[model samples]
Target: MSKEICFIADSSGGLPREILERHQIKEVPFYFKFQNTDYYCENVDYTGSEFYRHMEKNPEDVPQTAAPNVNDWLGALEERYVRGAKNFIVTTISSRLSSSFQTASLAKDVFAEQHDDVQVEVIDSNTCACGQASLEIAIAQMIESGKAFREIVDRVNQAVGSVTTLFVVNNLKYMEAGGRIGGATAFLGKLAQIKPVCEFIDGAVRPVKAVIGRKNSLKTMMDLAISRVSDWSRLIVTVQNAEFSEDADYAVDYLRKAASYSGKIYRSDLGVVVGAHSGPGAAGIGLVEASPLLR
Candidate 1:
């Protein structure tokens, strides 16, 4: 691990444990209130998919996820700072989806107030899950190559603009309840039995199109994601799902047969906080054109 810099992200990214350990990435936990009585910390008490599975039994739960406060972010940064890392790169979920970005920025401000000789750069990745993980991995590579902190920060922001997350939403009710979509829009989509394709654009989830069925929606998402790829020579494709691993596997197979990518394919789950808004049965293809410091 580089003692000069540290990389941190909220747990909503659902980054694999191996990657987190290998990259020395620190994850700040997000919280969710279960049954209006119990509080569960995401990735600590349960995962993204696990949340949906529990919801299956209840069937009437509305998600109430909370972002880590300034203190939580401060504590995470302080831990790394105490370990001799003067530079911190904090990545948060889209500012639109959650207030994590703003909270993390506040924490950075607090760190700056106390420490005169440290750098903290927080990025609103405008994405979550696989998309966020891609950005984290790329920054880790940059750190390992001994890149300057400023260069890595610039690269991180540039990479955020390159994130394309095309998702298949099985139901729109969850989005509507979470304020991601309007009631009329969700009503109309469900009324027609339409499987919607949503895109994470400019830190907001917007409807892209309507596909015929769930299977077709999965194919359409993958097709759209691959079609938009500027180049495959430096690309990372991730297929992630919320309680739908079989569909994720199918999407991966389709990606393999469709085109050749130099970078690897990641299989991941949407995090609990994100999954609550996206809802169960949501699957997505995260396509990131690489900005790497070391191959």
Candidate 2:
């Protein structure tokens, strides 16, 4: 008998609505606390833009994010299993960044024990936002190409190491409030107009380079990312902005003129999970090379 595979991701994966609907990808949402009230990350009650607008007005009370509990993961998996899926491949934000990966793994174990016929595999993307989305999209393509389950799992695991997540914040106040950065660093960065180009290294966010302005920061990130690609034609790129469509548009234009990458460029909102910390006006580029060209 042939096996049916289902793809699942957490809210931090930053997948757009169309991709979610088209691929039939299931999601578990993360929760955030705003002014003592709890709000789910992708809930309709509070949209991404609305979350950012609230944060902008209430700068003192930046929202706090919470990873989905094991029950949440199990619920999503159970629903898919009831719908005739025999195999599940779950991807989540970096384990180092959140407990979602661990929760998903635990849920898989429990669910598999209850249904001996089902198989569940959890992957720690080791990246977030579009980086995670890119990996999920690649796996969906593999599924469409008729790859075996074992081969798909191995390829997805290997692809995690090749994915790159990079971004620049317009203001560091949100980061500082979230305790991701020191207040002194935020203050100094603001004073110097230093927009630091950051990337995920070893599953942690780290500053790679600093530029004087937002435009330069975006360009630097794109140039550095493009320089690492081995095959431009196979490149998968995602451009995202935090309540800043103009900046996202600018990045898309820059990618066309600068990298000359002809592949489809996935564009999405940064989403509230990342947006809460990145703040408004932030923009980023995520690149996943079809094959790694460098160390």
Question: Can you write out model 2's per-residue Cα lDDT over 140-216, one digit (the tens) per residue?
Answer: 77776667777788888877987888888998888788787898998999999998888877778888997999889
Return the lDDT, model 1, position 207. Answer: 83
Model 1: per-residue Cα lDDT over 1-295, one tens digit each? 5788899989877777777888889999999976666778888887666788877666678778899999999999999888888999899999988899999999999999999999999999998877777667777778888988898888777678878878887887888888877888778878778888888888888889888788988888888887898777767666778888899888888888886543588777888887887778888877777744334
Name the weakest run of 10 consecutive residues (lDDT summed) in model 1. 286-295
lDDT of candidate 1? 0.82
RMSD of 2: 2.6
Candidate 1 Cα errors over 4 Å, as ranges:
291-295
RMSD of each: 1.8, 2.6
* Residue pairs that clash (backbone atoms under 3 angstroms), model 1: none
